[model samples]
Target: MSDKRTVLVVEDEEMLLSAVSMEFEDAGYDVLCAGTAEQAYDLLRARPRVDLLFTDIRLPGQLDGWDLAERARALQPDLPVIYVTGYSNEQPRQVAESVLVMKPYRMSAIIDVARRLGVG
Candidate 1:
């Protein structure tokens, strides 16, 4: 496996996915892009070395970000996660303390959070 820290970015929107992937890459992380929950799962299953997971709260398929986070946590408890959302609705109480980044966040903010979490 490569030595660089790997970050998995899960977002359904093509443009947003590309943008976030670029942001993480620019911040000196090895980025893994997944457009759906299933793809994220596949990536995680196939590549267990991922250090960070950045997922959108509202995904396109049957499995949402919360579900994906739970599953990923089960697979690798040490993995850090950051959830991104645009809505103001109540988030899941179980993972309330998990890192969250509001939509339209700046690259610096994302990098700061990743640094704080010791992921970058």
Candidate 2:
């Protein structure tokens, strides 16, 4: 087992996922990349030590990022989430201890967030 803090990134776009995964990895996190809420749930359930969640509001499946965060919170209540989307004006509701970061964001900003959250 590795000591690197784990961050689960749920994004539908392949390019976005790859880019974000690389950013997190470079920031020293063990990133778990998933394309859907269900897949994210599986990764979250399987890995008890996932330190943070950086997910997109929209996803590939029926369940959205909110659902993913809810399920993940059930497994790990203290999980810190950052929702990334293009429409930052449409504020999210019922999010627990989260940050809404707009898309077209600097990857370095996300890395800074992870560091602040103590996730690698």
Candidate 3:
């Protein structure tokens, strides 16, 4: 596997996902993107070296972001996950403790968390 840090961005918004993917790529980290939980799971299963996962709480389909986080954790015990959402109250208790970032966040905040998680 490559030594470069990889981040899996699971988001439903097309523009936001593209922007975030660009940001992370510009910062020199490898990025994997998925629009739904099933896509994310497929990427995870196909690529086992993902270092961090950034997912939004509100997502389409039955799984949603919280479910994705739980399932991702089960698959990769030590994988660090950062949850992003505009709907604060809807976030699950289990995911509340993990790194929760509000939408419209500054790039600095994302970069800081990525660094802390050891992702470039």
Candidate 4:
């Protein structure tokens, strides 16, 4: 068993997902990538634990980031969540104890939040 903490990153945009995943990886976390909320849900179900969830507000399929966070919280009640979105005007229905970060955020900022959340 590795000591490295894990983070599940959900983003529909392939490039953004890749970039974010790489940043997390570089920051010494076990990075899991999902292109949609459904896929992220599946990963959450399959994995025993995930240290953090960094997701985009807008996503394809039946669930959005808010929906995914709700479902994930059901599975892991204390899971740390960070919601990222390009649309600042979108009214956020965020979960408790979670952070909402706007688009064009610095990777370091995200990593710092994860660390503060006790992830890495």
Candidate 5:
């Protein structure tokens, strides 16, 4: 077991995922990268502890970020979520202890949000 906080990041865009994962790693978190919601869910089930979920709203599979968060919350009720979307028209359905952030956001700002949500 590690003392570092863990964050599972889901993004279809390879560059974006890498950037976000790197940022979370720089923030002292155990970063898990997934390109789809299904992969994220699998990690959620396999991992005993996941401190945060940072995911893109529009994913490849049937389950989007919102569904992914809901499912994750079912497994880990207190999990914090951060949903990102580039599509201006797309809106997030509310989930407890979660925040929706527009695309092209600052990584530092995300880290701050994670900290506020009780994750290091």
Candidate 6:
């Protein structure tokens, strides 16, 4: 296992996925990239030491980020999650208090939030 903190980033868009994953990796984090919710779930099941989850709310699968977060919490209760979404319809009630970054969010803001949440 790597000594660096690991961040699992789930996003459907290819460019965004690469950009965020690269940023985190450059920041010294071990990044696991997933293009769909299913892939994210597979990673969660396979890895025992994920330090953070940064998922986009709208994914190309049955489960969205909120659902993924719930499932992840079941496996690791204290796992920190930062949700990214373009829709402002209604923040999922369950994760209302958690970090939510809008679509046009600056990457630095997300990194700052993760750092505050104890992730690298």
Return the top candidate by lDDT: 4
- Across residues 4-117, which tens digit of lDDT does each residue of candidate 2 receive? 888899999999999999988887888899999999999888875788999998887788888889888889999998888886555585466788788899999988877776
Worst 10-residue lDDT window for candidate 3 reads 89-98
Candidate 5 residue pairs in backbone clash: none
TM-score of each: 0.92, 0.92, 0.91, 0.97, 0.96, 0.94
Q: What is the lDDT, from 0 to 100, of the residue 75 in candidate 1?
A: 89
Instruction: Please give the lDDT score for candidate 4.
Output: 0.93
Query: Which residue segments of model 2 deviate by more than 4 Å?
Result: 89-91
Model 4 segments beyond 4 Å from truth? Answer: none
For candidate 1, the 10 contiguous residues with the lowest summed lDDT are 88-97
Worst 10 residues of 4 by lDDT: 86-95
Which lDDT tens digits does candidate 1 get at residues 25-95? Answer: 88788999999998998899998578888999888888988899988888888778889889758756335
lDDT of 2: 0.86
lDDT of 5 by residue, 1-120 (tens): 789999999999999999999999988999999999999999999989899999999999889998999999999999999989988685558697788888789999999999999998
Candidate 4 C-alpha lDDT tens digits along 1-120:
989989999999999999999999999988999999999999999999999999999999999999999999999999999999989776789989899998889999999988887778
lDDT of 6 by residue, 16-118 (tens): 9999999898888999999888899899999887999999999987998888988888888888899998998975734533687888888888889999988
The TM-score of predicted model 2 comes to 0.92
Off by over 4 Å in 1: 93-97
lDDT of 6 at 80: 88
Question: What is the clash count for each candidate, in the order shown?
Answer: 0, 0, 0, 0, 0, 0
**Candidate 1: clashing pairs of residues:** none
| Higher-lDDT candidate of 3 and 5 | 5
lDDT of each: 0.85, 0.86, 0.84, 0.93, 0.92, 0.88
